[model samples]
Target: MTTHSLIVTGLAAGYGDSDILHDLDLTVPAGKITAIVGANACGKSTLLRAMSRLLKPRAGQVLLDGKSVHKTSPKELARTLGLLPQSPIAPEGITVADLVSRGRHPHQGLFGRWTREDDEAVRAALDVTKTGDIAERNVDELSGGQRQRVWIAMALAQETEVLLLDEPTTFLDINHQIEVLDLMTDLNQTRGTTIAMVLHDLNLAARYADYLIAMTAGRVHVSGSPETVLTEDNVRQVFGLESRVIADPTSGRPIMLPLGRHHVTQA
Candidate 1:
């Protein structure tokens, strides 16, 4: 498996006339699971978009293995980096098999016919995601959890060295969320794929991520191991909430316990 270094240098990007991400700098460690967590409107998704080349950077550059992503050929870049957007549009009536096959696009050359390698990749992806049973089913007909896994299967079929996911667990139940995160871990360990994702659940992120990046107001507030990045003071500063950070007895990761108005009585 090939590992690619992803870095952002002074990145600034957003919608027209407004920048959601400030002069941000980050380096996603090669072959590790890095989770970006933050409050709403903190630019976590914007940073992922910039890294995936979905959104053009206004001021700086995203580098993949020391090469500018903006300047790379789209097909070449796609072959090396796979991105599962927050809300990817599945073509109406497309089947799971067909959607997964589309991931082979970058690997196919001009006038190239679909080969056994493509079939194998697609098959492996579906099997790993446990979507093989629904391969022929319409993607639109699947439940939210199933649909998300199908999208992830498509990304897996891409066979890229770097995988970027924007809220991959969105709309998933607790079990499904754990399943997806576990699948990501399996992929990283087995294939050495670099995984970077934006997650809303701080506890889950801290538990699953080897490295954690916490953002606030368009900049990275803090980033490190879960123990160092997730602390009482950091939580209060970044989330504007009082909370107790406890060690998970099972995994030894930090678990946040948010205290609200009603949770805190006069002491």
Candidate 2:
């Protein structure tokens, strides 16, 4: 069984007067992929933000390694936890290798020394993301898929134990989505990285996540394995849609078949 790497208790936060997350409690299992899924306004991004220390919780606490995130220094916290937002701006003239190497900034001193260890991490990240060939290419010149991989490689180079990614596959084609997800799975398996991602693609989330969290009205509706959470009832309640849940041919995990307006059959 995977140990708990991070824990949140009674977490609540929102924009101004509106409360989006209500006493949300969760545990991220060490070295496992935990995917959070819900409709818009369900506090998916808010939760991820709180976990990454980007947003301060209004009510409860987010604990990293049994210590409150509010107490940890930013640089110290970043050395243990990394966050990848849905969309990130890259420096206009930055090369792919340079962009990935920037991830080692946390390990650098005030003078920003470029150590041999930093170079090794950058190389390893490029190797993992398969972006070594484009190492010297300007990041802006790459396709959307290639750019996403570079961003992921940058996160890989951070060498943090926990990585929280928000919509990691937004601009990629289906194939690239699989490639990135597979890479994340490999990282979890080999390096014991605790990954939590907010994914809109239900089928892909089902295929990749070791644990699934369904949120409704700013609270955890239910959570468990793919087969357990992606049920017809849970789908209808959380997403306001009906769907057939079937086994994934490749992974044997539950795959949701959304029965939206376009997918509904005329009676």
Candidate 2 stretches with Cα past 4 Å from truth are 1-4, 261-267
lDDT of each: 0.94, 0.90
Q: In angstroms, how far off is 74's CA in candidate 1?
A: 0.8
CA RMSD of all predictions = 1.4, 1.9
lDDT of 1 by residue, 86-115 (tens): 998999999999999998989998985999
| TM agreement with the true structure for every prediction | 0.97, 0.95
Candidate 2 per-residue C-alpha lDDT over 1-267 given as tens digits, one digit per residue, 9 for 90 to 100: 234369999999888888889999988877899999999889999999899888888999999989998789989988899999878899999999999999998999999989999999999999999999999999989998899999999999998989999999887899999999999999998888999999988888988999999999999999998889999999989988878888888879888887776856741
TM-score of 1: 0.97
- Model 2 lowest lDDT segment of ten: 258-267
